[model samples]
Target: MTTSPILVTGGTGTLGGHVVPLLRSCGHDVRILTRHPSTDGVDHVAGDLLTGEGVEAAVAGAATVLHLAGGPKRDDEATRTLVRAASRAGVRHLVYISVVGADRVPLAWMRTKLESERAVAESGIPWTALRAAQFHDLALTMVEKMAKLPVFPVPGGLRLQPVDSREVAARLAELTLGAPSGLVPDLVGPHLYDLAALARPYLRHSGRRRPMLPVRIPGKAGRAYRVGANLSPVGAGAEVGKRTWEEFLAERLG
Candidate 1:
């Protein structure tokens, strides 16, 4: 079925950089809604989700709205803005990319994502929210920052399932092209490892050998990580992603 022009938020972001191309490659007419006017070549409309600027024009006549923009500070308002605009424009489906265990994770950032999920559900637009594990690049970035110190310090017993952003983008593209299924199964990495273990490959690849020390993190956030609240233990929709953390690190750091 041919889709109406698809409007994508965060088109230049980590996930959007992949999702937009996949959509276009599949022959969907993709347009980006961004603060800046430029989309690096793809058609784009300037908009700001926080202030509701240029959003209605962006959402106008869109069959599906793939919402991938948001930060801790702006996620709630941004999602609300997009939902209202999409509902008004009669968008058929809205696809959102969110983090896994957002509701359970004790962080302000996670709370914002959870709030955004709720807003999307209540928006009255046919919508699907896909929760994904940490992107491998982000995990590697954390390691990159920690390696700068003489010794690498990480929260004790914290675990992560780092999925590839490209894989996550592929799943989002599949959902955006299909019907809206609320709160779909999570997309997680093939392997689960502790923070230190996750960082080891990066450490070895960069030839930076420092003692990876585990330090106890205080408060509820730390406890959440220690308990693996962020993990998708049962493979809700696992085995779909074949890229391993080591492979991602090799490509990134090596």
Candidate 2:
């Protein structure tokens, strides 16, 4: 007997790109909804979550829904739209991907994720929200962007335990297959490092030399970052991933 497909929003995106195949490899049919359907191996549905176009159709008859569409813009509103569509379609489980310290961090993106989490919880659907640390892919991208500059500017007192995107994807897949259990513990990186230390390896790998300048981002947000709102606490019910930042850069830059 075949099971219903797992519907994934942002299926073409970073974490979703890793997750789609893993879910398929587990013997489940995966349906990915995107505004513009691509020629990927999975079933692509043309849909837009923000405008509620094709959302119901995309979610229809799916056993599970993985909502991983994250950005500074349209995240919270898209989540709300998805929750409503999932509820209407009677989806068995709705899994949300969120930032680790979304609730505590003063950053706009984190706040948006926090709001999205609340939408899922209040949707009255069987739902699970799994918050994860910064993806190493993102970290690499940030470092790559900074490498272009003559001098690398590091955020003062900001430390991140950047976990691999694939690890986060694996965790999301597990939750998507299992029962919805509200909020799960954060999936964090194995170790933590400050910005300068994190940037050094990237520079070395790319054969770039620059002075690491520590810059304070003035305001309440900066203060929150300095206080470690983004870093998972010790024994905070964290699921530590194996891939370190160094390993990530070595693999990519080697």
Q: Judged by TM-score, which candidate is best? A: 2
* Candidate 1 backbone collisions, by pair: none
Give the whole-model CA lDDT for all candidates, comma-separated.
0.88, 0.89
**What tens digits encode model 2's per-residue C-alpha lDDT throughout 166-186?**
999999999998889899999
What are the per-residue Cα lDDT tens digits for candidate 1 across 1-254? 25579999999789998999999999889989989867367889998999999999999989899999877586988999899889989998999988988889888889899999999999888899999999988988788888899988878868888899999999999999999999988889888888788878787888879986769989998888888888775656644478999998878766
Stretches of candidate 2 off by over 4 Å are none
- RMSD after CA superposition, every candidate: 1.6, 1.1
What is candidate 1's TM-score against the reference?
A: 0.95
All candidates: TM-score: 0.95, 0.97
Global lDDT for candidate 2? Answer: 0.89
Candidate 2, residue 10: Cα displacement in angstroms equals 1.1
Best by lDDT: 2
